[model samples]
Target: MREISLDRLRTLVVIADLGSFAQAARQLNLAPPTISLHVAELEARVGAPLLTRTRGQVRATAVGQTLLERARRLLADAEQALEEVRGQVAGLTGRVRLGASTGAIAHLLPSALATLQRDHPGIDVQVQVLTSQASLAALRDGRLDVGLVALPQTASKGVKLMPWRRDPILAYVPADWQPPARLTPTWLAARALILNDSGTQLSRVTAEWFAAAGLYPQARIELNYNDAIKSLVAAGYGATLLPQEGEGPELDRRIVCRALRPGLWRSLGIACREGDGDRATGHVLAALKHLRQ
Candidate 1:
C-alpha cells in the first residue's frame, strides 16, 4: 500500500479551504495539473472520493471534511516539528503572530513582549489588537499563533484556554462625578454607561455583572475597542467598567477608577489552537507564565 503523502494532504486542505482546484493551485503556487494529480493520489490512498467537483466549485464530502480536519492538524504539527528540530538553539527565530484585546495591547502585553524580545531577539512578533471574538476566529483560522484573551465562560471550538493573570475590573467615572463611599447596584444603575461592543466576552461579562446586581443602566454607548471606551470616559462622556490596566496617565488625570466593592475581576489568559502545542509554543507559554508571576 502506498503511504499517504503530506504533499497530497496539503493539497486536500488547500482545496477544501479555497473551494477550487485553480484557487488551491494559485495559493500553493503549483500548477493546476499537479494539484489534480495530488488530489487523485490522496483519493486513491483513502479509497474514496475526498471532494465533489462541479463546474467551478469544489466541496468536501464527509470523508473529505474529516480528512481536511486531520490534514490541517497534521500540517500544523509537521511545521512545528520542523521548528522543534531547529530548536531554541535556533534562538526562537520565526514569525509569531499574536492577537490581544486593545486593553491588553496597551498595558498588559507590552512588558511581556518586551521580555520575550529581550530574551529571544531572533523571534519576530506580530501583535494584532482585536475584539476577543475576532481574536478567537483568527486563531482558529491559523492566522494567529496565539491569543491573550479574557477567559470566556464558554471556550471556542479549536482553542485551549489557560489562565495567565487576573485584573481588577473597576468603574471608571469622570473626575467631576463624585459617588457615594460604597457603590450600590442602585447607584450604578442610575448612571449612564459606556460598554464594550456586542459579541465580546468583556461586554457579555459586563452585562452579567450588572444583571447580577439587579440593575439596568441608563442609556448605554457601545464601543468596539477598550482603548476607545477609556478615551470616551476620559473625555467625561460616561462612566464605564474597565480592567484596572485601563487606568493610565490620560485616564488618571480626567477620570478615577474606583475598585468595585465586592472586587469584580476579569481573568486574562493565554490561548492557542489545540494542536499547536509544540516546544516553541510551550516556550512562549512559559514566557507568559513568567510575566504573570
Candidate 2:
C-alpha cells in the first residue's frame, strides 16, 4: 500500500470535527471537490469506509476515530520538532561547551555566567576545567565550543585567538611574614614558594618573570589548582605569585596579597575554531568578552 498523506488525514479530522463537508472545506481553504477527493483517497488507503453522513451531518467510523487520535499525535510531534529547530536557528536555545582554567572558572566566569543567564535563560553553558594548552587542543579537536586560554600562545592551526584580559600577578604570602610594601623578585625568591606545575602556561609566565631578574628560584611544591595553592598559603606553607582576577574574593585572614615591584602580569585570550559559526557559542563568547579588563 502507498503512504497515507497528512493532508488527507487532516481533511478527515476537520470534516469529523465540523460535522459538515462545506465547513471543513472552508476551514481548510480547499474546494469541496478537493475535500471529497482527500476523503476518497484516505478511505482507499485504509481499505474501509472512513466517514458516514446521517441526518445531513458528517461523522467518523470507528477506524477513522482511531486514525484521528494517532494522526493528532503525529502532527503535534512534527510541530514541536520544527519549533525546537527554529529556536536554535534564532539563537534563543542551545547547549554551549566551554573550557577554562579553575581560576578563570572561579573568579572570572561567575558574573559573566550570571549575566548570560539573565539575558539568555534558554542557553545552557557547560564549563570544563582545563589548562590553556588542553583547552586549545580541545578546540582544535572539535571537543570544545570555546576556550579561555593564557595569552602569548604560539598560534595553532584551525584556532583563532583573541586577547581578552590582562591581570596583574600579585604575591600571596602568609600574614605572619611581614613582607615588604612591594615584593621584588629577590624578596619572593628568598621565601619558600608554592608554584604552578611546569606543564601550565602560568608556570612559564612565572618563570619568565624571575628569569628577567636573573633569579631562578625553586618551588617547595608545585600544583595546578589556584584555590589549593591559596589554602596552602593561608596555612603558612609558602608564598606564591598568581594573578588577582578583577575584584576577586577577599583574601584569607591568614594570608596577605601584595603588589609586585616589577609589576608582572598574566594575559588571557579567547580561543575558538577558525571560521566557526555556532549561535550558542557566539552568545557565550559575547558574555565572556564583557569580563575583559
Candidate 3:
C-alpha cells in the first residue's frame, strides 16, 4: 500500500469541518475537483466509504472518524516537530554535547553554564567528563559537539582547537605542613604527593616540570578526579600540583594552595569538528569563549 499524504489528510479535515466540498476548496484555495479527488484517494487507500451525505451535508463514517482523530494528532505532532527544528536552526534552542576534564568541569564550566542559562536558556549543554585525549577522540568520531581540552595537543584530522584559557599550576598542601610560599620542584619532590593519573595531560605537564629540574618524583597515589585529589591533600595524605582555575573554589581549612616557584602553567583549548557547526554549537562556543581570562 502507498503511504498516505498529509495534503490528503488535511483536505479530509477541512471538508469535515466545513461540511461542504466547495467551501473546503475555497478555504484551502484548491479546485473543487482536486478536493473531491483527495477524499476519493483517502477512501481508496483505507478501503472504505469514509463520508456520508445527509440533506446535502457531509459527515464522516465510523472508520473515517477513527482515521480523522489519528490524522489530527499526527498533523499536530508534525507541526510541533517542524517548529522545534526551526527553533534549533535559529539558535534559539537545542541540546549541545560538550566534553571536558573533571578539573575544568569543576572550576571553569559553572560560570559559563550559568551565563548560557541566563542568555540562551533554550540551549541545553550536556557535559561529559573526559580526558583531553578522550575528548579529542570523541570530537573526531562525531560523538561530541565541543571539548575543553588541554593545550599543546597533537593535531588531529577533522578537529580544530582554539586557545581558550591559561591558568598557573599551584601546589595544594596540608596547611599544617607550613610549606614555603613558593614551592620548587626539588622541595615538592622530597614530599609525598597525590598526583593526577598518568593518562592525564596534567600528569605529563607535572612530570615535565619535575624533569626539567632533574627530579623524577613518584606519586603516593594517582587519580583522575580533582576533588578526590584535593580531599586527599586536605587529609594530609599528600600534596598535589593542579591548575588554579579562575580564583578557584574555596579550599578546605586543612589545605593551603601555593604558587609554583618556576610558574608552571596549564593551558586549555576548545576543540570542535573542523567545519561549520550547528547554531546551537556556535552559541555554546561563544559562551565558553566568554570564560577566557
Candidate 4:
C-alpha cells in the first residue's frame, strides 16, 4: 500500500492551473525534474496517467480532472483548518469568504465589514457579489462560508437560514416625468420597464407585483446592474424597479425614485453551513446582526 503526498497533490494542482510542467515548476520553486517525479509518483499510486502533453502545452487527463477537483477541495480544507488552529493560538485570525447580493454588498456590508474588521483586526473578510441562486449553490458546495440572499430562497437541509432585513422595492422614472408621489401597478406596468435579470428573485417578485394587478409590463430592457438600469431610465429610455436600499444617494440626474403603490419589499437573509464551527464566520455573522440592530 502507498500513501499519496500532499506536496504531489499541490504540484498537480499547480500544473493543471499553469498548463505546463515547466511553468508549474517555476511557481513551486522546484526543478522541472522534481515536478515530473511528483506527477509520476501520483500516477503510479492511482495506476493512471494524470496529464497529457499537447503541442507546447500540458492538459490534465480524464483521471486528472477528477483528481484535480477533489484535490482543490482538499487543499482548501487543509489550509482553512490550519488557519483555524492558528487563530485559536493567536487572536482570532482567519479568512471568511462571504457571498452577497449586489444590494447587500452595496448597502449592507460596508458597515458590517467595517465593524468586523474593527472588532477582530486579525480576521480577513472576502466578499463576492452573487445572485441569490448562485449564492445558495456556492454555500452548499463549501465555496462560501456565508451567503446573504433573498428570503424564501431554496432551503437545503445542510444549511441554516437567518433572516436579515427587508429592502423596499421602488420605482424609478425619468426625472422630468413628474411621476405621482405614490406609484400604482397599472401606471407602472404601462411604462416601458427596465427590470433586473429575468432569473433573479427581484424579477420574480416584480412579476408577482404585476400579476397581482393583472398587468404584464413589457420590459424595454433587462439587466443585472441597478446603476446601468438607472442610467438608462434617467436617459428617458424607460422605467425600472429597483430595491430602495443600496441605491446611491444621488441617482443619475435624469431619474427620479418613487415608492411603489402597494409598498412591495424583498427580504434578505444569511445562509451558512449547518453547525459551522468557524470562529471567523461566527464573528462576521455577529457583526452583521449588530449592525442591523
User: Of the candidates shown, which would achieve the greatest lDDT relative to the real structure?
Assistant: 3
Please say which candidate is ahead in lDDT: 1 or 3: 3
Clashes of each: 1, 0, 0, 0
Instruction: Name the regions of candidate 3 deviating beyond 4 angstroms.
Output: none
Candidate 1, residue 234: lDDT: 79
How far in Å is the alpha carbon of 125 misplaced in model 2? 1.6
TM-scores for candidates 1 onward, in order: 0.65, 0.85, 0.98, 0.70
- Model 4, 1-293: lDDT tens per residue? 87778899999999999999999999999999999999999999999999999897899999999999999999999998897789855648878899886767887788888898788998888989888888889888989988888788768978888888787888999978889998999988777889997988889999999999898777888998777788899789889888877445677677888999898998888889999457888898899887552
Clashing pairs for predicted structure model 1, backbone only: 88-91
- What range of 10 consecutive residues in model 3 has the weakest lDDT sum? 242-251
- Residue 90 displacement (Å), model 2: 2.0
Residue 210's lDDT in candidate 2: 93
Candidate with the greatest TM-score versus the true structure: 3
Candidate 3, 60: how far from true, in Å? 0.9
lDDT, model 1, position 106 = 79
Output the TM-score of candidate 1: 0.65
Q: Is candidate 2 or candidate 4 better by TM-score?
A: 2
Instruction: Mark the regions of model 4 whose C-alpha exceeds 4 Å error after superposition.
Output: 1-84, 88-91
lDDT of 3 by residue, 116-189 (tens): 99999999999999999999999999999999999899998999999999899999999999999899999999
RMSD (CA, Å), each prediction = 14.8, 2.9, 1.0, 13.2
* Candidate 1, 1-293: lDDT as tens digits: 67789989998888888899989999999999999999888888889999997887899999999989988999999998888658644546666788887777877676767787788776667888776667778888988878888785458788888888887778888878886555655667788788877677777777777788886665478887777777788788888887776334455578776767656778887888887455555656667788683
